[model samples]
Target chain A: MLKILRKEIKAFLKDRRAVMLTFLMPTILITVFALAFGSGGGDDVHKIALLVCDQDKSEITKSTINDIDSVKMIEVIPCAYDTAIDLIKKGKRTSVLIFRKGFSDSVKNLHPLPLDFKYDAARVQETGILQSILPKALFSGTVGKLITKEYFGEKLNMLDSATRYKVFAALAFGGALSDNNGKDISPEKIMRVNSTSIIAAQVGNIGLVQAVAGTAVMMLLFSLTGMGGGLLDEKEQGTLKRLLYSPVHPSQILLGKMAASIIVAIFQLSIMFIFASLVFHLHIADKILPLTILIFATAVACSGFGVFLATLARSRSQLQGMSTLIILSMSVIGGSMVPIFLMPQWMQNVSVVSINYWSIQGFYDILWRQLPIGPLFLTKVGILLAIGITLTLIAFRFFRKNVMALE
Target chain B: MIEVKNIQKSYGEIKAVKGISFSIHTGECYGLLGPNGAGKSTTINMLSTLFPPDTGEITINGLNVKTSIEEIKKILGVVPQEIALYSNFTAWENMMFWGGLHSINKTDLTKKAEELLQLVGLSDRKDEKIKGYSGGMKRRINLACALLHTPKILLLDEPTVGVDPQSRNMIFELIEQLNKDGLTIIYTTHYMEEAERLCDRIGIIDSGVILAQGTLDELKRHSEIKDVIVVECSQTPDEAYLISKLNLNVKVTDHTVYIESNDSKKDLTRCVIGCSEAGYEIHHIDIQKANLENVFLKLTGKQLRD
Candidate 1:
């Protein structure tokens, strides 16, 4: 047993690629996961941006904005109402807070405040966090005003009889919202929060849509990389030379493999979505056209990545080592393992470099956001195609220079 | 016809084929006989246009190898030293895949694949995956895949390595028939007998150089000895003493004395007398006509297997 163990150790050490990857894989994974999940680092915190449209322009509105912005995890950007709505429509901002014209007056007269909070329904996690934070900020702004009699007397003198009558009715409303002690009214009643989605989800669950898209792209990336290993196998078996010995060019062989891989990727994604639809009630049939196009574009990109990896490595073991490290790292950074929003702000910036980010985002637009086939959707498809084409070109060049050169 | 003019290939500091030059005529069976790492495969690779030489030229049938690689590929078939067939694929499937690379249509490719399988004597097992095949069977199929396009020239790099004798002979006969049908062939092997049996002309290469190349008779002259007298004895004779006494080249290995002879009759008589006088008891005596092995040994001062 000792002798066998020694022999195994020697053999393992001899395969430098395997040994290097054995150590490298875990080190890289732990580092990435720690960077993604660890806290206490100031820059690592993902500050959720809240767009504030303060039409009231009152002391109360200013206090509300300051209180919300004081939180370490939220950044308040004051903008006009039109600008806030535009930003939400264009997907520039996930959440928005609107203080209508009569917000400050209503607060003083003990009337229901006209405060509107709108968020993108697709970003359920981000909105949920925002929803929890928004109330505390509003309550803090109202607490100081409610504690002083001068705050109520000032608004009471400016009101007419008809308005005062309404104020009495509003006071009755506020009385019912208060707790048994009557001093501690809930944050919901304090601001009369009118929360709604800027763009509502067409699907039943946004999380399921996220799961189907994320898993599909991530798994396809892995499978396509494995398919790339076929190139190394041909090289080892000397079948690559046999193919080269034919009238075919090196580029043709690489492109042929890429094409086959793309077809397989498309098939893989189709099956994943079909399974998702049948079992999980994902509304894929309604968005079949866009989904098909997205899958094809994604497949092209992933197949390119696969061929690139195959051409990059000299042997099957090396390819295995490299593909595992690359695919896993990309999957994690690209929001396949976890949502990009949940990661550090820096990681979210880095996620755009990964192919998974674009592919998964494209699916989210169709399934979760129910986005139409417009410029935004086309841009995603274009980026994926560009990535695929560029990777294929690099793979071709590598095959010609390194592989076909017959070192 | 193929012409290789001082074609040199190098990988970094190691010159794989150092300015080696040779030519093959139409319908000629030319052999490159060398030990392992003797530039045989490098020369074949250059001729096949797998890569271009650093500073030389190769022309195949009036097309430059560097510029007209695709044209050359159309007429050349290569059987690499390693088994190049896809193991997961059956003999028929591998043939079809290779044949299809030549842009051969389905009907003709199908016909050609069947014919090649039949030629390799693997028609019955055409549908069997190659991984299940013996070394010889895989080799046979490896050769067959190259011939599906009916290339004018075939390059076989040690085609019979690790093959059983039966399959080796079968491969030999198949190559012989291909040559007889007027296909140009460049066969490389360390096995002198295979070269002697198949090639019309053979080139003996060593250390990235063609040490000697010619017809069998011409190469045999390099030995300068007509025959070798092998005397297995209880005690070996000193090589230097035997060489001086018998006036011939002598090599003593173990309990055997090998005497190279220009004149077998006179030389053999002198060898016997010399060994007797030297007190070496001869257990057996055998005479071998100087073949390529002896010629190779005489030139390189090492055994072919070395």
Candidate 2:
């Protein structure tokens, strides 16, 4: 058994093109995912150009523009109404906010303001963000202007001494009320409350990790299919018969080939994981034990499927056709090419039968969902091991029945 | 030693081997000679323990081929008709791999591989990939791989087909040397000359049945066809008149006349006189003594290659 394994490994390593392809394919996949998912860091703040067409040149409108510009997420650009409309039509600006003439009086009288908003329909996400933020900005500016006018004189601006005194008085009143209520309020309490409310979300490049794991599993299967061609090649070359002429049993030959493919798959997945961690800063090493077990089980299952494919095919061309049809379909349906959530519900339910589905889900559990090492993780591992063992037995039975009978 | 008794195999409705039986002594080169599709490979396959015979028994060294295949495989080397080495591996690597399969230790396998490579005159090219080697070189390595374990019995099925003359002679010499060293060999080929030169006994098979089996001289003596006479005439001869005048079995094709005769000298003289009396001029006359080809023709009424 060891001799056969050693020979198989030597033959695999000698094929330079195959070795290079195993690593090159995953690298390309990681790069494409990084580019598609916006660097995978999850911290990318989208900047949309917002054109403000202030028809009412009141102090309230100016204050509204300042408030909108204070948000780092949206860039505010002041333009004429006609120019803003032209820019929106030309698709240069995603959204335009218009302030009407009676906007300041409406706020002072506590009436609804006539605000007109125009957005480019093509930029749906940007338009949505702008629409959500515009209402809050307008209301805050209107209410602040009303408060300033009521507390201070109409001639006093927002930054005047009287307005500042009012703000100080309000803060002092709030503090005294808190003390009278027997509840001590301080800066530290506020800071502590703010910090406690901020949850520690799942860290690391989730998109990059998913991409690496998905592509790694899919490519691992592809590589196994290619490696499985060795079986047919040996039969054609008569080497399989020669091997049988030795003291080794036929099962040992099949085991040797499967062992080689499993090793290759494991090696491929490890390289992809390491590359993702080093280049994209993914947190693959956080749960190293579970991750390693998942990778091993995935490799075993895929390698078994590869052997099954090889035994089912009668020729090299047949193996090629079957592998293309099966691997691609599984990859597509199992969320390697597209996310499972994007797939139809029926298709997602059907994807449970695919090996890629279990592998990708297992990886997501560890790297993205950050599920603790528990039954969820063990369940994935169990399914993969079951798949590997079951498929391998089928392959062995078929091989013994069909291939071993060849003269 | 190997023994086969009434081995028969069939594929669905087609019978491939029909109750064939043979045996090889401890140190004899036995040849199974036949045309294509003659079940020679099937018989070799059965003896090699590749597959069990449908309704017969085979044993090697007193071990049943069906129940004792593992023990049988340890003592048999099969060099198939096809070149079976991994093309991507060097010749040395191929030898090592095949040798390792028999559980040969690394040091001994390496040493034996070197010795075999030297014997096949491929020692200088052992490190070259099999794909880069010529057809003859590949054939030589194929033979070398089978001999790695030094099995007691070697089953070679058309091992020299498509090989160049140099390699063919080299293979013949190698087989002869191995046989001289007490290796029992079962060589199958359609080439009569190879069988005549190498085999201690030849089994003439056709259409999945053994027509005859014996030494070359014994087969010749047993056959009625002692010699074949061919006469080239200047003009087409009348077939009816020639047969009437000579009162002998004669077949005329175009301007040539063919006759299978037990007495070459007497028949040639009679043919010359008979043709002269019939006003036919003889351009040339040739005579061939009885050999394996003629013996096969006499027994089966078909050429060995047919």
Candidate 3:
């Protein structure tokens, strides 16, 4: 077995295609994506620039100006109203904000009125997302803006048009979001939302990694089915008969072939590991015992499936066709292409039968989640073992029925 | 020595080898001759313990091929009709792999491989990958791999098919040399000439049955060629004119003459002085008889290759 493995590894190394597939191209893919990720690609908080046009520069206007800059989604750009509008029209800025001259005087005096502002819709849709966020944000931001109007400081609480309009707007638009429990919304709440992202970001990335790596590994099993073709190639060449006549059991030949395949599968598996680590930053820790078990079982499943595919096929072309169909269908239905959560409930329920899904879920609970140590040690390991054993036995039995008798 | 006794194999009632039996003694080459689908491969496969014969026994030196398969394997070499070699591996590597399969050690395996490559005259090309080698080179490598571990019995299935004549002759010489070294060989081929030149015994198998089996001369006796005599005379005669005038059963070519007659002495003595005067130097008188090729034809109802 060791000898077989050594030969297989040498052969794999000699193959330029495997080298390109396993190492070089994946490095390129990882480098490309990592640079893309760090740069935020096209859309993110870092790249947004906002413009504000204040026709009325007053204390209230200054306060509103301060309010506009507080939001993280926009980077403030000061400009004349016309210039701001022109910037929005030219796609130079994401959006522009305008405050008319009487906006502050009307609010300080006992005036019964409200203000309205307008801007280009095209910029808002394509480039002006940050501009439209300011008006409602400015209004909703001031805890004192919606307080009942006080007449002459006697606190004869009055409901004026401006306050009325604000109340009416709150009732109309913010009903779904209102914490009727009267919980005062604060910056702490906002900070909590942002900080929770550390864990969420980790989970999200690990999930994506598991999803992608699981698929690559599962499909890679198909590539190693070429190992089985070694047998068919030998048989086609009549070397199989020669080997049979030698002082070796036909079983030993099968053993050598399987050994060679497992070695190749190991090569492919390590490629997957490095790829996931580099591209997705797949986290592996000291829980290598479980990792080792998962890798071993996965190797078993792939090698067995390879032998099974080889036996199922009578020729190289037949193996190619049959394995292609089998591995592809399995990968698709098993959630290798898409997350099972994204599937309909019925489809998700059906995914339990998919080996890739179970293996992925096992990986999620183990490598991705790093969850409760109990589930990691027992359930995940058990399920992976079950899938691996069941699939291997199935493949072996199918091979015996189809190909062993072929000899 | 190898023994196959009434071996039979079938594939869903399509009897591939129908109760055929043959044995080869030590240091002898036994040829299995038949056409395509004649059960030659099926019989050989069963004897090699690849497929169990449905109802009989094959004993290689007292080891039943069915039960003692591993032991049988340990003592046998098989050269398949098609060069069974990993095209990606060099000749030395392939030999090492096959040698390793039989549990030969690294040092000994390399030594044996080198010697075998030298024996096959592929020593210089031993390090080159089989994929780049010619068909003959690949076949020779295949033979080398088979000969690893020095099996007592060698099974060759059409070892030379579509090979250049020089390579084929080299392979033939290799087989003879191996047989001389006490390896019992079961050689199969459709080439009647191969059997004629190499095999001490020949089995004429057809349609899953051995229709005839014996020494080359014994099988030839089964055919109706009772006599054959060739005369090397002192003179080149008008062979056709002499045949017409004397009413002789004669076949004449160049400086040689042939006759199939009940009384050889009368025909030869009468023609001797006349042929001598025609100025043909007498090299020698030679009389050769029919052999396995004739018996194979008579039984198969066709020539060997046809």
Candidate 4:
């Protein structure tokens, strides 16, 4: 076994081109993916410039402008209606909000306050943010003004009939002074606390991590398949027969080849991850141990898969075809090429059978979800190991029967 | 010593080796001489334990090949027909790897590998990758790799195929030297001259069966056409006249007349005298002994190279 291992290692080392290509390929792939996916930093806030055309010029319109400006992500710019339209047309501002005339009087008279918005539909993120926050800002601005009016202790008889009617109408709709219970409601007691159950974890550059891990796994399979061709090469060169003639069992030869592939895979993965960490700042250092274990398990599983392909193929060309078909299919369906979440639920479920699925999911746990190294990590590692051991056993059985039998 | 008894092997419906048997003594070089597809490699493969025989048994140095393959492997060295090398690796590395497989100690393996490389005239080029070496150099390394463990028996299957004459001669010299050093060898080749020059005993097989097996002289005696004499005539001779005059197996082609006889010397003189008296000028007379080629043709009714 050691002899075979030494020979395999020596052969690979001597082939400088193969070694260079093995390491260089993943670097190129990661670079391409990072450039394509655009570093999913998730840190940059979308800035939407809102041009407000206050035709009403009423206190209500001013308060609404302030409410919109209060949100840190949206910047409010007051301008004339024509200027706002011209700015939106020139792409200077992402959106424009127009408060029609009688906006305050309409609210006071229990009539609908007309507000119009013109936005850049091309800017999806900015448009989405504006669409969600604009309505809430408007509603909150109206309610805040009505509460201010009630705090002044002004009676309805002191104001005009239309004004009085609008104030009561605004209060009725705002739920601050609803008469359903026939009790006066205090705005201070109506607490507006914003809370979220989702805690933000320090997952650095998710897009870059996914790109690194996905490309690493895919290239691991590609490189291991190429390594598996060594078996066919030996058979063709008659070195396999020579090894069999030695004082060793056939299983030793299989084991030695598999070990060599696994070692090369681990080396390939290490170089890629180190490159990713240095260049892209992938946050693997926080969970290094589990990450290492997952990488090792993935390497083993991929190596075993390579052996199975080699043993199953009768010729190098056959191996080439089969490996390309299987590896590319697995990469496509296993969230290496496209995220599993983006795929249909059925396709995502089907991807569970792919080794890359488990490998990439394990990496996601460590690098993205920041899940602790617990049952989830163990399950992924165990499944990968089981796949490796089982496939390796099947490969050995085929080798013993087909290759070692001198077929 | 190696012994094989009625070893038969078949692939699908084709019988590759049909119950053939042979043995090699402790220090003798035995050759399996036949045409292509005559089961020469199959027989060698069986002896090397590359595959198990369908029937019968093979024992090397008193170890049964079926039950004691590991023990048999310890005493046997196989040089396949192909180069069977990792071309990317240096010659020294290849030798070291094969030696390591036999569990040779590292120190001794290095020494042995170096010595064998020197013997094969590759010591200076040992550090170079085999892919850069010439065909002859590759052949030399192939032989060196087999001899690293210093096995008692060496099985070379057509080692000289596709090699240049210079390398072929070098291989011949190497095999002779190893045999002189008291190593048993089993050589398989389709080249009759290689068998004739090297093997102490030759076995001629065809279509998975051995037609004959014996020493050079013994095989000649088995041939019905014992000797072949060629007479080159200055003038074209009539086939019928030459046949009638010599009263022996005579054939005329172009300007030469061939005669086959049990006694070559006597027949040569008679043919020369008869051709001279008959006014046919005999420019040259050549006498040749019956070789493996003729023996193969006579026994199998086909040329050895066919």
Give each model a TM-score.
0.88, 0.68, 0.67, 0.72
lDDT of 3 by residue, A309-388 (tens): 78777778777756765665566556576544333334445566656666666555455445444643455456655665
Residue A356 miss distance in model 3 (angstroms): 0.8
Error of 1 at A143 (Å): 5.7
lDDT of 4: 0.78
Q: Supply candidate 2's per-residue lDDT for B85.
A: 91
lDDT of 2 by residue, A245-301 (tens): 788888888899999999998889988999888888778767788888998999899
Model 2: per-residue Cα lDDT over B78-188, one tens digit each: 999999999999999889888988899999999999999999999999999999999998999999999998899999999998999999999999999999999999999
DockQ in order: 0.77, 0.54, 0.44, 0.55
Q: Give the number of the best model, judged by TM-score.
A: 1
Candidate 3 regions exceeding 4 Å error are A1-207, A285-289, A394-401, A405-407, B226-258, B261-292
Query: Poorest 10 consecutive residues of model 4 chain A by lDDT?
Result: A190-199
Report fnat, model 4: 0.89
Q: State in Å the error of residue A280, model 2.
A: 1.8
Better of 1 and 2 by TM-score: 1
Give the root-mean-square deviation of each candidate in angstroms.
Answer: 5.6, 15.1, 15.4, 14.6
- In order, the Cα lDDT scores of the candidates are 0.83, 0.78, 0.65, 0.78
Better of 1 and 3 by lDDT: 1
Ranking by DockQ: 1, 4, 2, 3
Provide the TM-score of chain A alone for each candidate, in the order shown: 0.87, 0.53, 0.49, 0.55
Docking quality level of the chain pair in candidate 4? medium
Minimal lDDT window, size 10, model 3 chain B: B220-229
